[model samples]
Target chain A: MSTNREIHLASRPQGWPTAENFRLVETEVPTPGAGQIVVRNRFMSVDPYMRGRMNDVKSYVPPFALDAPLDGGAIGEVVASEAEGFKPGDTVLHGLGWREYALLDARAARAVDPSLAPVSAYLSVLGMTGLTAYAGLLDVAEMKPGETVFVSGAAGAVGSMVGQIAKLRGAARVVGSAGSAAKVERLKALGFDAAFDYHDGPVYEQLKAAAPDGVDVYFDNVGSDHLEAAIGAMNLHGRAAICGMIAQYNSTEPPAAPRNLALVIGKRLTLRGFLVGDHGHLREQFVQEMAGWLRDDKISYDETVVEGIENAPQAFLGVLRGENLGKMLVRV
Target chain B: MSTNREIHLASRPQGWPTAENFRLVETEVPTPGAGQIVVRNRFMSVDPYMRGRMNDVKSYVPPFALDAPLDGGAIGEVVASEAEGFKPGDTVLHGLGWREYALLDARAARAVDPSLAPVSAYLSVLGMTGLTAYAGLLDVAEMKPGETVFVSGAAGAVGSMVGQIAKLRGAARVVGSAGSAAKVERLKALGFDAAFDYHDGPVYEQLKAAAPDGVDVYFDNVGSDHLEAAIGAMNLHGRAAICGMIAQYNSTEPPAAPRNLALVIGKRLTLRGFLVGDHGHLREQFVQEMAGWLRDDKISYDETVVEGIENAPQAFLGVLRGENLGKMLVRV
Candidate 1:
């Protein structure tokens, strides 16, 4: 195809983003230059972190430029290559998404085997989200065997993986909180010892009831009350890996919960925030162990895919609204 | 001298403790039992943490029992001893403060030398406060040479030592915040690169102006606005040692600052809370280092002394009110 369609940041949102914040544009696909590869994208990720980039604020990653195509994790087939070690017809992963075509320096893309798993898997369980859960649970929070683990947003991509990893790694009990009853059920199905719908009651009371023995490690996805609940139920010297705060991403006002932060002093707790980009050293070990878990049917994952690049904005909004389960993605 | 005047917890306060919450009691001095010693207390300590113990809440240490004498760091002369290696006239430090006389197991007391330093020094610079500053800065916060350090309550016992230690140990710059201009001046005299009176302006603005680059280590003695300010000024991977929350101790309302805690995720920061009791392993090294600093005139300390056992409760109230320049002590 000589034509390409991509989504751009039309405007910065004040709070919750809408379709008006994004613009879809059509342009001619350009030829690859020296040492560059052009890929026909298949599946692209719509992650919660993209919400932060939509705002005109500095963060770990730069804000998405206005009137420019937003980019993220994408898997596609290389249609042309001017670089060694990459060729046409090879499936590869790169950081140029929300588009039908991606042209980048060959070094930016990594070739993956289609026989090992579906290329869509590269956007979820076997990719950044999976590695995030791995490093955050084991390395960041340092979850030990026989310790109880509590996870917020337990049905979301990273949160689901964290709960399962805790159970698989010999956590005595795993408790999880989710927005809906359906998501809570999904957590239990994923082998969580206990799961609760945060909407049903106060998070502190629910978390207390769910993890009666107190949480030893907390994998935080949704902050605010979930964080306060974790702190209230955390055992002495318990730790928390602050991976994401999806609950507060669109908030124009400061979060009022986690008000019990003073408990950290008396309990001697540690709360550490981390980004997946910083944990690249664990990639090889993570992939090997994750692949083995998948091959042996020791773990499972779900995907909520929105067909067509035109719906990518909706997919991302769905993630923010908790409308999608597991990994939210857009099918190019 | 035959009778001992001790301070007892009269009642628990809902928000802030008052003189009414404490009662002075006079009782006969008891004979020492086997393995025990009776000491006539000279100097006693009144600290921020004691305020927490006044409440009937389960914390790291048990709450003070009603109508029972409060116990803490005290130095005295042994008037009677029944244990081996103990004798009359020997100076000892023990945990039986807020009283004129103390009777305790010999193991609970550590013999100290009066020639080394004033006995009251054991309650401030050469004791728990000193070790707290050492461990919280060097160990808990993992502060390294050439890093920028910011400390709240920077004129208090722990905060003053934290600033001096950071300066002596090669900190690139040290910024601190205090309640008054005098305390701010004291911090500057202690070799802080910059100091601010938190009462002058918003803590965030003052901290931003003081440490223009950013803060790498935050020794948090006062929470609320100070914690919020430090988080705002912290660089990537910055750490905070949460030692105390003197600002929030008496507040009935939840803290409204530190609302930007979500920044921890993007900034990849660590906020760790710790107690001095857990850092006993570092006491030997801390004492040696602190004693050397004192001897070489590398460090200095101040104590706000409130005379008489009858005024011990008022002294503790003064500490909570930030009336102390360094350590607040009760002289018996």
Candidate 2:
């Protein structure tokens, strides 16, 4: 047995989660049982979705159990194994995050080739984050070739990938909205045809100026004003894939829905909400396509790596505050 | 030429429309030009959608021209024909209402057999109203055989047909909400498994009591409280066909959107807004199936016919106020 440090949900958050809601504790790392492997986690992800999990309400994912280790996407090196095809030093991806080490069933962990790309990518562009952008754009929104695409939270993990994927797929115009002028410049550098800082003016005015002809598809991560603006700027038969509403996740009061939603009737718009867990069937296809794109230099990714498991809470809070320019992760 | 009395838009209404917004004027009915027929209208439909046309804003149909005769669904007998397919004494359906006579292009009119069903049925159950219910449920909502269906405006023409169609297509349960207690009982009489008066109590509590297992499809006609309530009681993968929002149509202020819209993510809900005009491809199939259902007594219909063209404006206002039980029509 060995000692490991892990973060636990000390209490459910009422509004914006605070560091007090999390507790870092040292515990014994159990030896591998039959069909189990022990892993020393190298990287763990902190995402906007985690804020929803901290609430005690039932959602697509269950709330983090009080005083228990909170789990999410993690990449690690296998230290010991008791199952067939067992090997030490094999890098694996699993759902055992916010921890220094994890004892996981072999079925829960999948081996990833470190030589294909950096192992940390397994927790980001090569993992659930990448798959979300792919499935959401191609399937949920049903993006078509040469159609215009608009994305909110363009500097974040899913939004950045959405804009790039849309571009690579032959989108005519790619427009993105971010919180700051710096993020807007970063989006332009990332190949977005048009980018705007939502802080510069009203989102509706900014979006109207960015997409004068209206957008065909809107990939929404930040809801509220962004969603309302998208609804106003959508073309006939436009589609909106509601991936995340990070803007309203921490609000104690129920956020008002878009007042212009009635415009959906006149425009024949479709707004659908989705979670990535329901789309595991697309993983193999996403991995194959994304690998080709990365090898051809058609896509790029960035990560803001916080140093330790103890800082996971702060990293997650940083994601909500728009402090991260791309995927936010903790280097455990 | 013959003298004809027609209804015209005198002025646009600011909030709820009043009789003063309409003008009844006498004009010369034009002689049939080449490929045109002069029809003496028998019945004119006063539908909720017409109220939208009273506004000058662009929509699926152009706004009713100010100080000119308003046009809508009408059934009439051809008095003079200069077209190949039409002749004198033939009953036809055309888009020229609020007038005693109309000069219509033969191609714009469809022959209706009064011997098979009431000629007015062409303007109600056998026409656009039926098509709206059919395509909205099967195509827009993508309803399955055993899912629960919830409809608002259940006592209205489209809503009544929607509930009946869902039941006939093997819905596990059919629930509806209307404005009056009598309308609730009428919905139950029309094969709706459960019905409620939205005015009796909070819509959420009533819908929850009516459908304990939750609704899988919501055919929304009355938006606002009903839509919000349906969202709350919807199951995973639920779909809402936004056919109309009678509740908010006349409101000067924008109605608040559903407060719990974030639930859309966890529930995987799809909300699509559609107009019946876009679903014309389903007309042949809808007419065939609905004709069979009507012939077999599997479906039924009702109408509140106002006596004359002079009462048409009042009948239209009645539709907005939820005063009509089913289809509201004006007889010439």
Candidate 3:
């Protein structure tokens, strides 16, 4: 039997995670039982939301058990299958724990068509991140043609998709905020009408100067300051879709919203916090549309990939710090 | 020509407005020319939104001109008319300035039918306050039958209407939060399934304990802390209609929000801010429905009438401070 490397929690971080918080262990690979297949992980994702899981707080998803193997979105190759609809040497994506080799139930894995897109692409562009952007912007934000759209963290995996999708849906202007100059440039090349480097100044001023007419739809990836800024810059009857708050993720203290919330009354703004998982009906439609965009080169994606399972915790910490560009990934 | 007594803005306030900010001015009442009419004022209104207009800031409506008479909702009798549709002695409601007498263009005012509801009801239940409650709850909150609803400031004019209307629509249960014990008692009598004083304890704990199944809809008349508490107590796929943020109206400093915004991602919550002016499409339908409710005694309204125009500033400041139990009005 082959030995596989696994990454387990060393200890939970108080705020930002560190490499020391993860412990690498080696375990013997067991034979696949009935209706099970062995998956050899190729690439894993490290997202900003993983920071919340490091704490023992009650949330939508349950907290990760202490000293247990960490799991996230992963793409792998099936070396062995003990059930139908699977065979030896097939690539798949599943919610298996972070390990070089994993024995997963055959029913839990779906065959990945390599000819359709890159295996790593599934972890970013054609995966949960893409679906989140589409559902939150279209279904929750209720974006209409000819309206101005603003996105926070515009260079991230989800923001990039949101800007492009807005353009495809005929948005009059698409503005986005990024942490670095390079990301802002990338946002422009990806069809954003305007992009601002948030580090240049208080995001409120930069956002106001960028969209003078006021934003019609605000896709919030960073909350608190961003939300307050959007409230100030929104036109009458604006809609705000709150998807993430990466800005407040590492704060031990409570977040403070600006007093401008009073604008909510006069402007008739709609601020909705939504999750993509809530809209199950849109899955097939999203997959079809996103696949077409990928095939036709209408959509482009960026990734900051790190190699080896030992680096997952550090990469996660980096994501929480906004150090990585686009979607943070680990190539095992 | 007849003389009219008008209340003009003398200065703006720092925190709570005082009587010194307003000055009663004497002016000649002009005769009706073309479509104009002279209205003998009966009941005048002072609302929290006027606080925003007092500041020389850009908003939905332009700031009140410095050293000029303040205009707001008013009910009066048309003592003279020069327009088609309006006749002498016809009672009307319009955006008339705070004064003993108002000279207005006839088309700017609407005739009030006291046979359907009382003339004061035009400034309260059949006016903007009632429309605000209707549009916020039905159009913005999107209430479902048998769903639980939670409303803040339930004894206030807007909140009172919201709770009663939700009950009329077959709400499973409606819980309300008010500032005083008397207001809480009034809310329970106003058809609230449960009522609590916010001064009792932490609203988060109170709301969570009272709404174990979680509130499906929240009609937010008070913002800041109340919003944070509601966020914690919301059920999966909840909707919040942000009508007004009375809690933060007088705070010089911004208030802090709980670090629970990320809960929106898990629960698929939608928090939308709105103003009644944008929902003019529902005006006639709301008037018809609310008038019927009032006639059948299915609806009840309360008013705190401050006697005379000289007390308008004090009355407005009182409304902002939540000192008025229901719709605060001035008898001219």
Candidate 4:
């Protein structure tokens, strides 16, 4: 008999979640039955949205079940397979729990090649996160060539991809906003024509400094204040794709948006809220395009890796606070 | 030579425009040229949108020429025609200014069937304003049958049509918000299941009281506070079609949205801003459908006419303040 280690939801958080909300426990490792495969975790994602899943409420996706393993994006190797699609020694990615090993359906497991890209990339640039940036930027934002594109949370996983993708799509200018000076510089190095440290002052000053002509399209990852700033900077007939609101997610007090909703009319702009799953049909197309870009060295990625599964709760908390530069991952 | 009594833009206003901003001037009536017709004004429209025209900066349409005839939607009688299609005493509709007489291109005039619909009705119900309400509600909002629709400025011209159209399309429940108790009652009489006066404390409170289960779609005419209220009351996957922002037009101070924009992601709503001319391709389709609805009594319309061309500015100010119920017009 082998031991299966898992992290379960110890409690629901009110504001910012504490480590006390998560519990690590050991269980008996059962054999995989028909149509099931066993995966030994290698890498796991600690994303901003994971904080939302821990709450017991309605959202785009269902909340994490109480007294159960908290599932998230994980890359692993098929240790055993009793299903047609997967075999032992094959590398895979799936929505698996915070555990050392997991029993999953063959359909849930996608066998990925290690030759084309690094294996951990499945948790980021080549995975669900990348697909989100692609669909929201291209399909939703309707980003046209030569238009200026601005992104919030510029140094984070999704925002980093959003800026780079906008540049690759031939945007005349690409601007990004991040929390730290280091992250801002990092974003500029990743092809963002201009990047601002939002913490230093009001976003209006930073944005004006970066994009004087105003932005034609804005991909918002950090909501609240960022949305207000984007509105001030959108040009006539501009488009804003609402992606995430990490800044306001932890606020128990009602959110505050400084007046600028009227900008929608003065500018004749279109503000659209979107979900990544709504664009799942674009996944194959995204993979093809992203693969070509990666092969040509036209795209690059960064990851902030935590060493162990036991530190996942802390890693997730850090992601929400902008503590990681790039995709936050845990090496299990 | 006959005198052409005209209303001209005398000055730009700071807030809540007054008579000082408009001037009625008298000039010689021009004789028609080879392809032109002399149009005698019969009916003119005074809409809330004209407020935007009063500003100095450019918008969807250029600002009204200062100290010149402020021309817009009007129905007139062709007193003289040197063109093939038009005849003497031909009842036509054109952008003939707020004047007793004027010369215009015959091609710019469209013959009006006053026998089918009243001449003033053509200026409101079958005019640009009607088409705007219809297109925004049906096309941009993409309103589905049996969905709940909430309209702001429900007793106003476009709002009235929006509610009726949603009802005609089999809406589940239609709620509205007006500025007065009389207007609230008028909305109920016009088939709105529920309505409240916006002056009754916070709009969010009144909105929630009216739509307890939450709103599926919102037709926004008055932006800022009303918009934030609607955003707070929307259900999951809701849609908001922004037709106008009458509330913010005359404000001397910049209005800030106190409502948090993050609610957009929480509810996954879509808010789109549109102009009627942008959807010009639907003109023929609109005429056929709106005409049929009128003949079958499937729809009804209302109007508030302020006599004399000089009072156009007053009527426009009244329309913006929600003092006029239904479509505001100036009969010259």
Candidate 5:
């Protein structure tokens, strides 16, 4: 047996979570039980949605228990196995994260080919993040061939993939809004027809300038002012896919509602919210299509990786502050 | 030729409109030209959507032209005809209101049989209002059987139809929010399983009590606090058909947005705005179903009729103030 280092939720956060809210703990790396396998985690994900799980409220996913090791999407190699069709040195994806090693049922881990793409991609563009973008744009927003699409948080994991998917699907115009000038430039480099820094001016004005004709689909990730801006810039019969609302996740006070929602009536708009977990049935179709796009060099992805499981909390905080350019992950 | 009395948009109102904004004028009732018909108006409809047309801003429907006769749903007897498929004394429905006479293209009028139902019924239960409820609930909201439905503006034209239709379609519970205690009782009399007077308590609390298990569908008409309350009480995968936002139509300032919109994400909710004009394709099906429902004694309707063409503006104001029991109409 060997000792493993893992991060635990030491306390509930009041506002913005800090390192003090997390604690690095040591535990014995357990042997695989019947029908179980042991995985040595290579990369663990720290997403914006995790912020919602930290709060003590009923949501789509349950809240993280106090003093328990946090769990999420992770990519790792099989160190040991006791089930059929399992072997050592196999790269796999599982839902046990923030720890160096995990003991999980063999059925819970999915095998991934390391030669096809880097192991980190399974925690990002080829994994949950990629599927979120795919299902949200194609199914939730119902993107058509000639329509224009606008995405908020355009440089982040899901947002970046959304813009690319929309463009590849024959969008007439693809626009994006990011927090910084560099991220805006990065979005343009990623094939977005127009990109704007929301801080440059009011979001609605910047969006109007970027999408002069009006947007047919809006991929909303930031919520609040971004959502309001999207509502204003959307054309008649426009659709919005509400993926996340990271802006108000940590606020102690209730966020002010978008003031222009009434425009929805005259514009005949549709806004729908979604969770990636509810769409697991799309995995096979998503993998087949996304893998082909990657091989064809039609899509690109980025990652901001932090070293060591001890730094996982900081990586999470960085994501909340919009410091990461793409997928934020922790290398254990 | 005879002198005809017609109402003109005298001036635009800044806040709530008054009788002074409308001017009754006298003009010669012109004879029908080629492919046209001259109709002596009987009953004209006054509705909430007309308030949006009073504004100069662009919307689904064009704003009423300044100092012109306002157009709306009206039923009249054809006094003269110069086109095929029509004759004198034919009762027809046309887009001409706040007037004692109308000269319009023959194609714009549809003949109705008074032997089937009253002329006013063609403007209310069997007209646009009925289709609005039918399509908004079945098509836009995608309501399912065994679901709970909550409708705002329960005593108004479209909302009353929504409640009755949901009940007849096998809704587990039909809840409604109205302005007066009498209106609440009337909603129950109309087959609403639960009804409350929003003026007696906070809308959210009242909705919580009315639907303790949460609502599956919300048909929004009154759009301020009632919309907010619906969002608060919606269950997972809930749907909202936003037909109108009468509460904010006359406000000088923008109404506050629904505060709990973030719940949409975790709940996987869908909110869609629709106009009855875009849904004219459903008219044939809706008329077939609603006519049968009415004839079979499965549905009932009410009309708050004000006398004369001069009282049209007051009746419209009364609708805005929730003074009508169901459909508000002008007997010209």
Candidate 6:
């Protein structure tokens, strides 16, 4: 039997998660069940939403169990298969991440064509991250052509795609906010009409400077001040899709910037929160459009890869701290 | 010549408004020009939205001019008409209140039948207030049958109607919060499944006790703590119609509650703000349905009438203080 290494939640964090909260455990690889496959993960995604699962509270998805491997999006090669179709060395995408080996039912894994794109792309732009940006911007916020759009966390995986999609859809102006100057420049390179670094000044002032005419659609990934700034700059009947709130995921105290929420009534704004799981209806359309964009060289994505499985916790914490320029992943 | 007594904005309020902010002026009632009519105002509405107009800041409606008559919903009889169809003794509804008489273009006034229902009914159950509740609860929130609904400011005009309509529409449970114990009791009588006085305890605690299963729709009339409470008690994919924020209308400081708005992301909640003006399309259908309810005695309405144009300011102030049981009107 081969030895497998997996990351486990040693304990829940008080506010910000630290390396001490996670443990790397060694286990013996088991034989595959009748309809299961054991995969050797190549690249595993570390996303913002995984932070929510670290808590014990009940939410849309159950909390990640303590002292158990935390599972997410992973791309791997099937090392052993008990299923009919899947064979050894076939590239597959599954929901069992944060480990060297994933033992899941064949139904839970989808075979991917590694020849068309890098196998790691299956965990980033061509998968749930890209789908989230596409669905949130078009279906959730209902962004109309020639309208102005504002997206926070503009350098992240979903945010970068949101900005690019808005431009490709004929948005008059797309404003983006990022944590660094380099990311702001990257946003501009991604075809954003205006981009700002939220660290320079107040988000409202920076956003106002970036988008003077006001924002018609806001794709919210970094909540708190970003949400407040978007609300302040929103045109009448503006819509916002609340995708993620990475800014306050580790905060112990409540945010104070959205104090002017009363303005929503006068502006007649709509703020809708959505999950990609409920948006399965848009997946087919999103995949087609996103794939076309990729083939035509109209879209580009960046990835920040960590070397070892033992660094998965650091990768996740780096995502929370806005250290990654785009999708952060752990390579096993 | 006849003298017209009208209320004028003396000065903008710093926080909470007072009688000093309004001045009663006597002016000669002018003769009607072509395509115009002079109306003898019978009853004028004093509403919460009027408070917003008193401020100097720009909003959906422009701020009231200093030392000028403040206008709102008024029911009156046409005393003189230069327009072809309108004749004397014809009752009309117009947007020129806080006055004993009004002279306006005929197109600005709608002819209303007084014999079918009391003319004051046009300002309450049969008018904009009723339509706000109808459109907000149904169209904006998209509330369905068997859903649990929670409404704040349940004793107020719009709030009262929202509770009744939800019950009539086959809601599984209806909860309401009011300012006074008597108002809470009235909500129960009005067919609310659970009613609580917001003063009794923290709104979240009270709401949780009222609807342990959680709320599907929230008609937010009070905002601030009430909005926070609704968000806390909301189930997955819950919707909130932000009709008013009376709780913070007079506050110089920002509201403290609803700090947990980040919860909207995890819970997949939708918070929408709307003005009654945009819902003109639903008016005819709403009036027909609301009128039928009234004729069948399926609905009841209450009003707190303050006599004389001089007391109109006081009546408007009373509305802000939650002093009225339902609609607060000034009989001129």
Q: Residue B29 deviation, candidate 4, in Å?
A: 4.3
Write model 6 residue lDDT over A172-192, tens digit each, in one string.
Answer: 999999999999999999999
Lowest summed-lDDT stretch of 10 residues in model 3 chain A?
A253-262
Off by over 4 Å in 2: none
Docking class of 4: acceptable
Give the CA lDDT, 0 to 100, for residue A47 in model 3. Answer: 81
Q: Determine which window of 10 residues in candidate 2 chain B has minimal summed lDDT.
A: B52-61
Model 2 accuracy (lDDT, Cα)? 0.92
Write the candidate numbers in order of decreasing DockQ: 1, 6, 2, 5, 3, 4
Docking level of model 1: high
Per-residue error (Å), model 4, residue A156: 1.9
What TM-score does model 1 achieve against the real structure? Answer: 0.99
DockQ (C-alpha) of model 3? 0.69
What lDDT tens digits, residue by residue, belong to model 3 across residues B279-312? 8999999988997898788988889999988778
Q: What is the DockQ of each candidate?
A: 0.87, 0.79, 0.69, 0.48, 0.76, 0.81
RMSD of each: 1.0, 1.4, 1.8, 3.4, 1.5, 1.1
Best by DockQ: 1
Task: Compute each candidate's TM-score over C-alphas.
Answer: 0.99, 0.98, 0.96, 0.88, 0.97, 0.99
> Which pairs clash (backbone N, Cα, C closer than 3 Å) in model 2?
none
B1-332, model 1: which lDDT tens digit per residue?
A: 58889999999988988889999999999799999999999999889988888877888899999999999999999999999998999999999998888999999999999998999998899999899999999999999999999999999999999999999899999999998989988888889899999889999999999999999999999999899989989999999999999998888898887899989999999999999888999999999999999999999898999999999999999999899999989898
Over the stretch B1-29, how does candidate 2's per-residue lDDT look in tens digits? 46899999999998899999999999997
Query: In order of the candidates, what TM-score does chain B achieve?
Result: 0.98, 0.98, 0.95, 0.96, 0.98, 0.99
lDDT of 4 by residue, B236-328 (tens): 889899988888889887676645676676577888888787888888888888999999998878898898877887887788778888988
- DockQ head-to-head 3 vs 4, winner: 3
Clash-forming residue pairs, model 3: A271-B271
Which runs of model 5 end up more than 4 angstroms from their true locations? none
